[model samples]
Target: MSREIVLGVDGGTTAVKAVAFDLAGEIITSHHESVPVQYGRHGEAEQDMNLIWEAVADCIREVADALEPDDTVVSIGLTGQGDGAWLIDEDGEPVRPAATWLDGRAGQRVNRWMRDGRAERVLEVTGTTVFGGLFPVLMEELLEADHERASRATTQFNCKDWIRFKLTGERLTDYTEASRSYLDVRDVSGFSTELAAELGQTDLIGLLPQVRAADAPGGVLSSGAAERVGLPAGTPVGMGMIDVAVTGMGLGTVDDGQGWLILGTTGFVGTLLPEVSRRRSQNSMVLATGRGRQVLEFMAPMTGTPNLDWIRNTLGLAEVPWSEIEQRARASRPGANGVVYLPYASPGGERAPFIDTAASASWMGMSLTTTPEDVLRSVYEGVAFSLADCVRTLDMAGDLVVSGGGFRSDLVCEILADVTGQTVVRQDAPEAGARGAAVLALVSARRFPDLEAASQALACPVERFEPDADRGLIYRATKAVYLQAREAIRPVWPVMRGLRYQDSAGDQS
Candidate 1:
């Protein structure tokens, strides 16, 4: 007799991953295909929509090929990176390349909205702060800059929704992705037309896809998709939440007051709430958790492990192993010998804890005496400090659940715990987003009664990093200096941006 397995597909910014898991949530097989991101000189990050779908199909085919002979795939669930504009025409063809969440071309519009109180009107209705990469902002930009292309788009899909549409012919979105844009966190009506009108994006109201509950039944696999992926036709699919919300579910953070963090390409710190809270950071949002009325408040820093990637390559350590890097970081003290590094290395600038499109990374207090080890350690500590900032802004307390590729280092987890002054519970699931999708698929398949029961059955913790009191005290003082230094550099960001623009223009000339 063949055992049943659930397949989960996560289409991320950089890759599309397909993972299969048994009923108990243990991984059975997995495959991933990398999707390229095109970065423009004007702070634009995009991906070819069709190429992304192709990657998804390829990944699924690989996973199916690796499946055991006795293992029969039962259900499919989909999740992906949230935000940005993934638009398609009536024929389901990409009207243009996807403008991802990292795109900052609409920075001027976001700034103007912030200054004119239009952003406030949006926050009042949506419970989300206006940012450059948000759908409405991007749509406004695209409509003004390329009216022809923009007019061709008939429906706006999120990353996963686009993939789901291609697989099951469902042109729908879930509540979680909807909350990132115009959805009122306080209401279940989905899109807020009034909010769209406030932003002068009323034309986009008709382009919005029908919103569905996260655990609801997504359409089944089509014959064409089934043949391409080597899966049986009519395999059930679940409407999965956005990547962040689904990842929280995968971490077993289903109850109110539960918190989680992801230190991946970006750093995210989130706390679940029983109700929508009015008070939130400009960089934080009150997002729907996809469970009825439950919400998540989170701050996402633009860059996370990329700081390490930057320093490693810049310092001629690209070939060096991460174990050596951790060793060097450990050689330095908790405070990194007074050097404070800001982890905003993204070209599009920082978003969470504060929205600054001109923000850039800096190493304050560096001296001739500063050792390489100190610099490396400060980079790690800087990212941790950023996470701590979000935790404090959200007023989150208690033990913090941490995951992602960055937390693989014991030293990173220890630093996070000490800097945040909280116990950091490290969960070792590498494919957390996919696992969460699989959990939702199980519920959609009626194999589980509810999300909580399904998640609890798969909850696994391999290690815990308790905060050191002495180190915590040291980081507290250092964090004060970090904040002071960040504020001091605020005025310099615009000046820096201007200089870069002039330099680029000169190069072009």
Candidate 2:
């Protein structure tokens, strides 16, 4: 019998990863390549589209080289970070630097749109609120600043779609990714004309490619792309969605009431819903799951890992292994000696609980006695508290499965369990996004009869970390202090906003 394989590509914010999966949905080999992100002085974060494509090409070739030439790669699936805007010319070459989701330049425009009562219409159409760094807001900003660039643009694509077009010579997007745009997501496919018109770009609807889902085969690889990636010409590629949605599918958390928390560069809390719940209006997004289901995503944009990176860099703690830091953090009592940190290093403000662009990260209640370990532990505790706040707001609290780079630390897992007062299930596979993309590819290729089956085949066993009864009590008590600190800081936000405005005005003058 001939061996059958599938390829999954995940174009992430920091890196592009590719994995080759066997018929049973087991990852045979994986390759990764990091892409550079350019950050400007004015809270601007961007990436070179051409660099992203080069990383993608490198990742694909690496994965293909690891596999046997005769091992038939039946299909390829593409998934990526959502909401970054990529403007391309008629020839599909990017016309501008891709604005990353971390960019906050559009906060003012998004706020104005919200104040004008346009947000409700946007929510009704796109199933998401006006958020900074989203494609529409970024595009609107570009159009306002340089009409020439906006007018000359032929199409607006996300990072993954750009790579897909480069490989297949076909322009298309998946419903899961499309839902993040200001376009309407209520439909299974295509943009919402009503929503597009309200955003002042009815003709912009013509610029978008048709939207599909993971189950649909998007297009075949062109001969040129095939030669570059070491794949057979005409290999089918499945329509892919956002990384978190695919992560949910990869973990087998696709049923209603089942949820997963991904702690990557950003943290996302998501649940798969059987139907689009109107209750999502309160504090969630109802997006397509790319498998004919709806996914409710309650995202918390900042996680603690980045803060740890900051500590390591700023404090010159690179000599110490992260495990040693975790060990020291474990020694500190809950509440980090009454200190707390807000991890908003990316400057796009925050997305969940409150959309405060003026919000900046701080370590409240620090004193002369505060040690580096205390501050570090406080950062971890504070991030867990924010994540807990998001999960608590959900109408239902289900079993929480945790994935991503942060979950590798047992100390962080214990802290999460203690703070959330719930069991934190750790996935067996660390690369949930890539595995999810492969699972989708398998389903699209009919290797699995259904998504659930594909999940069962691909889903790895997880280790559950339950909260300690005694430690849980301490964490609960400390959580009160954390919440109180957060509340106290909320009122001072306006003052901080005033200071920021004055700074901006001075700069302009």
Candidate 3:
């Protein structure tokens, strides 16, 4: 008797990972292929679509090879990073390099809309604020800046949608991805054509793909893809949601009031709710959970482990191990000796909890006696403080189910639990996005009745971190200072932006 396995593919900004899991959700085998992003001088981030597809193919082939002779891959689920514009022509070829979610070429456009009240109008209709890298905002910029690329584009697919098209030859997107900017937050599956017209993007209506639920019946594997991936032709393909939604599912956060956090390339934290609430602040995204009409009030603040990465690299500690860095960081007492770091290091600047493209990282209260360890530990605390801000904005009150590469350190996990005042639950596993996609595949294959059932059956065991009373009190006081420092530094962000570009202009001239 052959063992039944499901395959989950997560096309992330850093890599394309293919993970195989049994019916119980235990990982059987997995493979990853790194994908590179091309970063531009003016907040432009892109990737070659064909290269990403090739990486996905390589990962799938490697995972297929790892399967035992008696093991059979019954279904495949797909998920990836959401937002930005991946333009494709009628023949399903890339019109240009994909504009990724990290791209901020449209920052000025977003700022224009915000100043003219168009940004708030977007919030009113879509239940979310506009960011530079959002699909619609990018589309508006592309149309005005690059006529050739805009005119050639017939469809706009997110990262996973592009991969799905290559696998099944299907052009479709799920509600999770669509809800980023297009679908009405009140109506998960409905398109807002009026909002499209208001943005002067009515042309986008024709470019949008057919929206479906994450577990809905998607296309089968095509013979060409089967040959390339070494999978059986006609294998079931599950229409999986975005990495955010699927990661929540993989963590078994299906019930209302469940909160989850991802501390990867960016910091993401959200609370699951039964339905959309207009009363909530519009700063965060209101997304379809891809499990019935459930909603996820989500925020992706531009802060994460990258703060640590930046400091480590800048201070010539790249060769040192992360564990050693953590040890040194721990030597510094709580509050990093009065140093508070802001973790907005991304060139695209900060979004979520607030939108500010000119935002940059800073370390305040640094004295002559401050040590490098203080700087390092303060970076971790900055990220924790940012996540706490998002949690407060969304009213996410309970245990936070946490995942992502950043949580590997005990110090970060403990700090996050104390700072947020929530018990942090972690499953020490990578490829959670892929695991979530596998859960969706199980439901799509009809082996499970619904998302909730599939998720419960395949859930991973967790390790919990309880908040320390003393540390929580200290964090509470520090967080107030953190918020105050953030606001105080806001007035200088634009001046910093001008100084940076001035240096660039001097070099160019």
Clashing pairs in 3: none
- RMSD to the true structure for each prediction, in A, is 1.7, 2.4, 1.6
lDDT of all predictions, in order shown? 0.86, 0.77, 0.86
lDDT of 2 at 233: 94
Candidate 1 structure quality by residue, lDDT tens digits, 193-292: 8888877778787888888888888999999999988888899988998888888878988888888998888889988887675345655877886677
| CA deviation > 4 Å runs, candidate 1 | 278-283, 503-509
Clashes (candidate 2):
0
The residue ranges of model 2 lying beyond 4 angstroms of the native Cα positions read 186-190, 278-281, 290-293, 494-509
lDDT of 3 at 508: 48
Candidate that beats the other on TM-score, 1 or 2, i.e. the better one: 1
TM-score of each: 0.97, 0.94, 0.97
Residue 187 shift from truth in candidate 3, angstroms:
2.6
CA shift at 21, candidate 2, in angstroms?
2.0
- For 408-474, candidate 2 gives per-residue lDDT tens digits of 8887788778867788999976688877887787777778888789888877778999888887777
